[model samples]
Target: MTNTPTHNRERSCIACGAKASKADLLRIVRTAEGISFDASGKLAGRGAYVCSPECFDKARTGRLSHALKTKVSNEEAQVVAQALQAHIQRA
Candidate 1:
């Protein structure tokens, strides 16, 4: 078999507009159910990336909902942020 170089997919943070490898950013998915933190980054829905909690805070205001093309309430955003924080702490 021919050897091939692995390619890292790059994505932009919705909050800061910073570019980075997909794995380096936290992913949030929006589906019919609602928006939620996507730790596995494999959820089937519209996804948005944020580089950090500070970025997430910025995004949660409006950027994230705009990126996802849905209305994300402040309460929903807070819940997702909490989940993301818990995940980060565990990691």
Candidate 2:
């Protein structure tokens, strides 16, 4: 019998720099369309991770823009934050 090793993808939080499983952290994606929360974790774009809402807030200040390699406007950040808040409430 052949044995195979399972792989778990890990990502770092853009805000606090914490390492965690990709699924455990929230993903924010920036594409041509714009930036938004990627709940599916399979969005086709530059993605950054945040481990918690507090971290997410910190990310909006500047870290997210650096990670995405694009300028994140206040409006876009607000929209994404709203989506994250809704998703958290849902969960």
Candidate 3:
């Protein structure tokens, strides 16, 4: 018998419009506190995905706020960007 591996779930980056595996992307969640990175991908709130720091920067302009249906302040955007960058470096 032959065995095959199933493909991981796919999601589109809000910034670049590139498609990638959900696990390969970073998830940003909108909650009562505000917009933040959801590393577990299981946060209970609206979520958006981005493929890289560049895409994250693009999203910060407006796409991210639109996706979350809430205004994202510059500080919030900066925090998320920094968090993603740190995450990328760690990985």
Write one digit per residue (lDDT tens) for candidate 1, span 48-87: 9999878999889888889999999988999999998998
**lDDT comparing candidate 1 with the true structure:** 0.90
* Residue-level lDDT tens digits of model 2 in 15-90: 8889888999999999899999999999999999998877889989799999999999999999999989998889
The digit string of per-residue lDDT tens for model 3 on 9-75 reads: 7789999889877898999999889989998899999999999999999889799999999999999
Query: Candidate 2: worst 10 consecutive residues by lDDT?
Result: 1-10
Model 2 vs. true fold: TM: 0.90
Candidate with better lDDT, 1 vs 3: 3
C-alpha RMSD (angstroms) for model 2? 3.7
Can you give the TM-score per candidate against the true fold? 0.89, 0.90, 0.88
lDDT of 1 at 36: 97
Residue 46, model 1, lDDT: 96
Please list the residue runs of candidate 3 whose C-alpha ends up more than 4 Å from where it truly belongs after superposition. 1-8
